[model samples]
Target: MKVNIRKWNGVAIWSWDVPKEEVCGICRASFDTTCSSCKFPGDQCPLVLGVCTHRFHTHCIEKWLEVETSKNLCPMCRQWFQEKTDDGDGGTGAHANTNVHSSDVVSTT
Candidate 1:
């Protein structure tokens, strides 16, 4: 028997490494999906992992932190919000301060 192929279509799927049920604390959107403020998912709307072990969309957290009442605190645990960084010791250095303040963010509209 002989077979002849003319054309083929390929598709690929990708998802974040976080658990399927996990969602952004600020927007309550799944890790694989974009937050309410963004139009698309993936790198353009990246996720931020807090020192408190909570994750949120970068835009959501940035907007949240810009509020005077937020006080740069994590929405999930009420702890000071800071980005978790690798300390070169294989352990997370959660104490690194992001120093994000309301004044630091400029309002476009």
Candidate 2:
């Protein structure tokens, strides 16, 4: 009696629903990490996506919005950066333009 053996090959792919491939526009730092002002990245400085689909670090975007020049506009699209409402869960939820009056807004993650 004789037996034969076969080898199997497989591939796995991973992805995230982020708006960009890398880095926050405002701070120019990788999405996987936090901005300069933050002592740590990750959960402490998670990424935030604007209604315009522009991406930035959470801390970075907050600082940018606080500036008088920003006027609550997305740096990339110049669209009114609608604020996101917390889902009550740990993650962020849909976009709510409670301040502005634009119909082109999209939900953020």
Candidate 3:
């Protein structure tokens, strides 16, 4: 099922929270431009894509997906996170939470 802006917005509103932005993956610089639709924090994790293509401030994904029982993945690519892994292990990083199946959540796209 596709989760439209209204739905995500409602969810965020029901929870009394807002989207996060500003913060780079490597340099910790404030993010000024990011596609809210396809870019998110996990997208900015130093553990992801190596070089950041997003500007989610690191808090957006952290606040939304970070949980003890929950494993956070890139909402955009649905790929596992990793800073720099060479031992393989599915290419997951040291801080990677776990694999998140795209079939599990409402599609934001």
Q: RMSD for all candidates, in order, please.
A: 7.6, 10.3, 17.4
Clashing pairs in 1: none
1 or 2: which has the higher lDDT?
1
Clashes of 2: 0
The lDDT per prediction is: 0.86, 0.72, 0.42
lDDT of 3 by residue, 44-78 (tens): 43222321233233444555356644365445454
Q: Model 1, poorest ten-residue lDDT window?
A: 89-98
- Given candidate 2, what's the lDDT at residue 59? 82
Angstrom error of the Cα, residue 94, model 1: value is 6.1
Error of 2 at 36 (Å): 0.6
Expressed as tens digits, the lDDT of each residue in 17-75 for candidate 2 is 56446778888877765688777656666777665667788888899999999998898
- For each candidate, what TM-score against the reference? 0.75, 0.59, 0.26
lDDT of 3 at 101: 93
For each candidate, how many residue pairs have backbone atoms clashing (under 3 Å)? Answer: 0, 0, 5
What value does the lDDT take at residue 79 in candidate 1? 91
lDDT string, candidate 1, 1-109, tens digits: 9989899999989888899999988888898989887788998899888778898899999999999999998988899888887767464764466457898999889
Badly placed stretches (over 4 Å) of model 3 are 1-30, 33-55, 67-70, 83-109
Order of models, best TM-score first: 1, 2, 3
> Which rank order by lDDT, best down to worst?
1, 2, 3
